[model samples]
Target: VESILDKENFTLEELLDEEEIIQECKALNKLVLLDAHYVLNSLMFSLRDRAQVEQLLRYIVEEPSEDDDSKRTFKFPFIACEIFTCEIDVILKTLIEDEEFMNLLFSFLEPNRSHSALLAGYFSKTHQEVLRQLVDLIGITSIMEVLVRLVGADDHVYPNFLDVMQWLADSNLLEMIVDKLNPSCPPEVHGNAAETLCAITRNAPSALATKLSSPSFVARIFGHALEDSHSKYGLVHSLSVCISLLDPKRSAIASPLMHYFRNQHMYEPPIPVNPETINAMLPKLGDLLMLLNVSSDEKILPTTYGELRPPLGKHRLKIVEFIAVLLRTGNEAAEKELVGSGTIQRVLDLFFEYPYNNALHHHVESIILSCLESKNDAILDHLLHKCDLIGRFLQTEKQPILSGDNNLPTLPAAGKHAPRAGNIGHITRISNKLVQLGSSNSCIQAYLQ
Candidate 1:
């Protein structure tokens, strides 16, 4: 096996075990991580003899064709990429800390480059602390702009770009992409921006929650979706970032986001829960509800799922989930505006209107459970006086089985996707919670009675 930082003529591939995957004599990083002794000492070992840093860069930059093959070029890119993932602290720090080396590393990403995905893994491996240093070396705006340009410059580069974005996201520097989310920006930029944010949200929601926690940031995210509902991709991903941030259980390390008014439970929201953001989102929800509540002859759904139609079905699902969070989280300005909007009825309407989709039911149930658990007088009043809470539940009760559709609320009914074991069911459980809460509150008690 090759030694770290060894100047004694050695091949980088030797650093990895002889018979593991990806290429027999090559290193697979997952296996490298398991080398406890190597990981513990790899950093110190690299520092003792730093020359290997330059050696790895040569493999990455040259990225030679497979045939000509010098000893290092044979599997050079693979070897360098995998090694960087090992003792990440040592190799990544060495690459990014030195401005000259950093520039060489980035050269692998120059426009029209081939084999970018592997090269991107190299970029993604750089430590975020290096972000500040690199930013100082070359302005962040320029760097991201160039990177985004490189992304769209070639279709081949797109997937590879995501690999680099993972590093940028961890580094907390998505400013350019976030700004590009504005509808005012070229529509072309909007797709990439939305997707980049979507990827981050999907891959690392909690991190994104912390990274984009500003009131203004949250507001802009939803604002763009409304301004440019024209793009299905934009609206879907824009809403995705919002909905992920609202995850009640996410509880991102609240920043100044905590200074705002609290939710019903007084818990910190995943995003800032900006009053402005909530305000922007409601009209869309209001309009969507109006569409659902109406007796329209126009074809609304493609199939039994009852989603709005291409690029739109997914968007509607995200919108419902987003509203569910807002309802559960309880922003005062949001609640006051949303009260008596028939949100519960509208979502429940979606529940029965759609073909069996457990995802839709979970969100619909969230809205119902949120209202049933409400401590706010206005919400209780809305539920009892304004909306037909009891009648809706009755209409919803045992609907699938009684109608003999044989539809089960549960998906796959038997696997890990299955719900927990319980003798009681959805309506029964909600009814019980309603009864428990009504036991304590006069308004709720009156409604229950």
Candidate 2:
């Protein structure tokens, strides 16, 4: 029987016709559908007629049987049938849509507290694949209700049906999880539910956008994560990443995104990197900064690509427009504090120590130059080495601009043929104009000195 089943293209009718021979042959191969893993593996291994196999699986799955004895333990056969069958669509559609069958099926989800964990842990590609097919075939609203109910189980320690949502995205299922996982709920519930949704939507930005665009829903979701209730950094960070991915555009939505971040949190200042958490958390932070329009220097700085080009570097420039928005809003306090306390210096040090060969040193220098030019002295005050660093940066950066010199562009700086102004005000005005009008980057460096 096993040999026949193993053949590349055998048919189900062939197996059934030789039932007597199969029964006898079973002594050697030992039909293991009476047991679980063996049963699933057997089903996975078999490649007989799909329709007939599905029929056999349905019979095993749907047949009423007692559960107290090994002889009565029908779990293995049911699971095997689930694995071997390709038309799970017919099974799930009928099972999930039929109220009686769905209740019976859902009952199996818990499988009694004693056996639930071990049995649930038995979730294989077969079970998830079946669930996905079922979700697709069933009504979205109905499936969503079932999902919310399942997740709401206080005893529901592990995340199930997560892939269902992913499959839904693939099939254009409205990320219905967003609605079911209510944000107005308690903090723990909200966080767990949000994590579940994020797990589904992490790489699916359009689906993420679907959730965030719903104003009330998006606001409550983020508000709880940031937990205005208690300034937790991790939740705030997660919320930031979510908001970034959501790409909230409206003033109403974007306002809350920034306001919560700008609002000071009281959590114990960030802890030293736990190798496990750093990799997971850093990328999310980078994405969030991109959405929040927070400067790279202000929050997390770019780490990829070589440094020694523009002040911000190549990696940072791609997102420079977003960072510039932070300056326009005058929300640099957090950034200032971050830089003042050594974070900025550490980032710069890292860049110089690991320089890249093709680094464009001056364009980045131009950006930083532009940024410093627009800022008031107060913002610049916190940036230590403000003058000297600019000087060093200019020395490295000015070569290209100098090379492009056309009649030196008539620099505003005073030289051998310069005119003297009559009053202090005039001199100050001329000095200010010179700073702005210092044509070449090199000339600007000379004027600053």
Maximum-lDDT candidate: 1
What lDDT is reached at residue 279 by model 2?
A: 28
Taking all chains together, each candidate's TM-score versus the true structure is 0.47, 0.28
Give the alpha carbon lDDT tens digit for every residue of 250-308 in model 1. Answer: 32323212422233245333344546555655556565444334333333343322223
lDDT of 2 by residue, 6-105 (tens): 6777754444444343333333234344354443344333423345445444334343345544422444443444332344233345444444443333
Clashes of 2: 8
How far off is residue 343 in model 1, in Å? Answer: 3.1
How does candidate 2 fare on TM-score?
0.28
Q: Which residues of candidate 1, in runs, are more than 4 Å off?
A: 1-173, 179-211, 248-312, 398-425
**Model 2, stretches more than 4 Å misplaced?**
1-80, 88-106, 109-126, 132-196, 199-275, 281-449
